[model samples]
Target: MLEEMVRPDVVVGGYRIEKKLGAGGFGKVFLAWRDGSPCALKFIHLESVGEWGWRELFIMLRHEFPNVVKLLSHFKWPEEKPEYLVLVMEYVPGVTLYQWARDKNPCARELVEKLLPLARALKAIHAKEVKHRDLKGDNVLVREADGAPVLVDFGAGTMPGAPRVTGALAPANLRYRSPEAVAFFLRENRKRGERYDYSVKDELYALGVILYVLVTDVYPFNGPDDELMAEIRAGKPKPPHVRNSRVPPALSNLCLRLLAKAQARVPDAEALCEALEELLEEAKADPHRWEMVLCYGWTADGRTTDDAPELVGHDSQAWLRRWIRQKPKRGRPPAPPVVAPAPREPPAPPVVAPASPEPPAPPTVAPAPAEPPTASTVPPLRTRVRRAAPVLMAVVGLAVVVGLGLAHVLGKFQPPPSTPNPGQSVLTSPVPAEFSPDGPTLWATHVHEVAPPWKPSEADAGAALSKADTPAPVTTVTLSSGTTHMKKKAPGSQAERAKKGNGSTGANVLLAVAAAANMACPGAQIRKEPAPQACPAGAVETMTRQLGLRLGERHGAGMPGEKQGSSEPVPVKAGPISVELAGDWDVGTDAMGRGGRTALPNGTHLTGQLCIGEKRVYGRITQAVTPTGDTFTVCMELIGQFDDERGLEIKSDGGAIKVHPRVEVKTVDRFE
Candidate 1:
């Protein structure tokens, strides 16, 4: 039934076959590419997959579960080969749990961390009322990209009470079977007529076995099937902590509860997931302790590699020495010439004052010769004053008597009286002629006017409007006695006046004009003014605004929201993407092939020039869906080898592309 073999470079159902994955009870699986993405294609013989099996597979595909294998699409070959059904699925790139455990030899913490996702995946499966009857290390995959565990191999699964596809009473893994499952098998084989039903509890027991193996790197119960069954029935398997002392008590207890003999004692998938999440949180909180238990073959004692001196940070002193050696020699920088400071100046000597000599006594003046006063020095001034004193006094007395008489004469002649004060004249002055006899007027005479009665008059009658002389016509009409009157004015008459017989006031003309403006000019203000007087027939003034931008154009030339000088290049939509990919090409299936789309974690879409080296090909990944999964393909015309780098180059026209980090490439490899 599996005889139709597909080789490398074969094209099947629009998928360019790259390599073989593996085979299972269902059929052969192959790694293929379609629509610029990588996918897994599985070929199942319609005869071997009976009605029940197909129905169960369909049910599984219809359900969506996280961390579980997804089915993308399915189709039956119509003409060329009608017996085969093709299923395209997500191509998961990672390693099996068996290989992961063996290669990594994970500690208790790492084992729990990796297995939590698988447990949660089981929870998702169970939530859909489906059971993975066969749960084992080989059915679980650990994604190399992020250590996430993906649950797979749902061929042995079905909804509760559904008939079995293969008609097998039980799975072959006896060491991992629960006690009740083994008891049921023994009863059926020994002719005991007791009926047995499989429950999620049995699957939980299988999960416990997988968890035990992942943590201890050994089966919980091993040896021949008979012996293993006896051990399982006896419920004598050692606690996970006993096998691995490093296992936390909480984790060990949870594992033991899963392996409980009583069906009611086992925890459901939700409880198991919760317990694992708590355990994971505890492990992450003190990562150092977990790291000690879970070294990835980096340290001899399983301790953190960071603690090893050999693996410590680079030596700055060594780097400095190498840098110094590499530098050009300039005579050792001349030793930077040792500069000595100048010597200190000596202190000045202390100053002292000299003794001052006693001041010499002033020499006595010499006596002048005793010569008698001659005729030139004749009479002393004192003798002259005494002789003139009596004559001067008698003259002074005569002059005093004459001054008294003159003073008496001058005193008698006084000035005439001055004019009267101006204050008295002001009190006697009369009011000016311009002064008003009465007080000023009041507010009633201004702004407030009584409305007048209307009276018809000659001016109110239709008068000849002189087009040449009058720009505005009188609109208001005067009416008296509440009577209407009509009178025609002479031809060409312009001036208007009320008829004296009517006792009416002349009509008043009031012109009220309303204007509306609508205009918009980019970068300019719109102002509305009255139209010109000469404008005819409601014509509006046309304005030429100062425009800052051209017609139908924006102010700036750059794309919206993009800065002028930012370093990030604008993403081009629907651009061409050139790819360089190389890896093994084979044809089979079951997640063994490696070449596919460079899928980034978290389902991110990537495009543009992508260069995928062989190391990027981890393994085949499967995401479950219906009909077919994500399709990817590479054309032969675009395939070529890169001489410098070890990869095949493929130039593609991606209608639109987004770059992702899944594909590793040098800076120069990108060509938009």
Candidate 2:
């Protein structure tokens, strides 16, 4: 969210743009201060989305829902820059329910008790006209302040009584939506020419699911896409008691009622709250049942501290039947076990004539009680003992099973340490980005790496200018160029130049550098000639070198600086020659021992500067280098008697290497 902070162009309503707080599909929310008190500001994103926020705000204007995140004020973005549609609203500062759940995971007696408040808070939200389309753990922000949870992100949708958010994105909760909502939303966006309406029952149903998860830590329905949806919509959910016998029948019945698909099965939020309050009161009175519900729980992944039974099986059917058929509960005497008259004892005495007429089937005697039991018709000690024995044994087995399951879950299910590995890891950092109502601005965690000159230095200028020489036209070799008139020639060099008129000596120097460079920096190409004309607008080269290279003229090699004494645009040309450099070319050095810049093969001279930006750079690049094709360093500098200021500009053709420095390079036309 930090990434979203930007100064808005215009302030909306009375709130000045402070910084963006959070944002979503509809618009961005800002942390704003008014009259010296902090208030949240929400701005619409686009006109379409803004309309929805407008509608929702209108519907909920004065109504207040305690558990919901507060909505402060509304406004229209001041400008019509398609770029930004913004909004500002209340700022919520509580931890999300997901985080709370994670902290309190591995539900136990204490944790389950903690969940009751969250369940109630959800109940409150359902009471409000708003349906928190999303009821997932993350959507529920739980702050222990005042010992209650708060729901936030009162988001976008065509809420029950409200129209779509004029500026809202969309209101849909993927994780905890009810079956009907899920079907309605998934079925089609529009039906019968009207948009589908998400109902309030959906929220209540979601509330029931929340309770279910709180108790069991598992969704009643489980499976893959088609399978999971089918599971949610299909069969009867098992009672909570089935998962944890600690859950009393009363609570289990409540769960079943809420879970029932029949719309009337579960009451509305208000009624549900009343029922829950009663159940909770009862639970308080009965601690044993409460303990059991708390101790055993489930996760959607089938994790349970109690024996988890998938009730859709034969044994489950038998058990359910047995439970149903248990002799009418204690107080009700099962309609007096019908008794028939006792047969005559004489029939028994006639048993000796058993052989006679099959003894008349023993006269069908209905035996009389040997002894009249005290008030109760208790079964014999033996019969009673036998029946009670299995139940006691079953109880003992269940205890053992519960203990083992608890050990397995609690023993191994400790929270894993926070260390990410390749499989689930992505290179992520809090991208200094945040949500803004006016639209997001690009924010960087760090500045981009670049090359720039902070100081003006001859070495720097030369380095910038003397980029690699161009690929010369395939032609014959010749050289031409001119020198400034105002130089006090060095005696020995002057004598040397005069000794060899028209600089046959300079030509010799060129050939020598080219030859040595081939073997020295053999990989390096040295032009055996000089440039004939000026390069394009953005490029620059030395006049002497330009004329000497003769790369400009289309026709022929006019002459070398054969007319050195002349100051005319010396027509020039060069014969077929490959690029080469001297073996001992003095490379420029930086504050560090060595620099990457290499001196131009002696005869080459600085013609002019290239304008990169506000500055003119001397290393007017002649051409790009090979492979990745970026400008290589060059050696170029204008000669003057003494104090002349030099500046440089850097630039690129805007490709992979889009950035460069501002070197002050001067331009020249056909120079002699």
| lDDT assessment of candidate 2 | 0.37
TM-score winner among the candidates? 1
lDDT of 2 at 480: 16
Overall lDDT per candidate, in order of appearance: 0.40, 0.37
Q: For model 1, how does the per-residue alpha-carbon lDDT over 26-99 read when each residue is reduced to its tens digit?
A: 44577899888988887765644444346546755678798877888877753474766777777888887866
Clashes of each: 45, 96
Cα deviation at 11, candidate 1, in Å, is 1.9
Which regions of candidate 1 are displaced past 4 Å? 1-4, 49-53, 78-81, 160-172, 188-196, 284-288, 294-672
lDDT measured at residue 56 in model 2 versus the true structure, 0 to 100:
53
Error of 1 at 391 (Å): 99
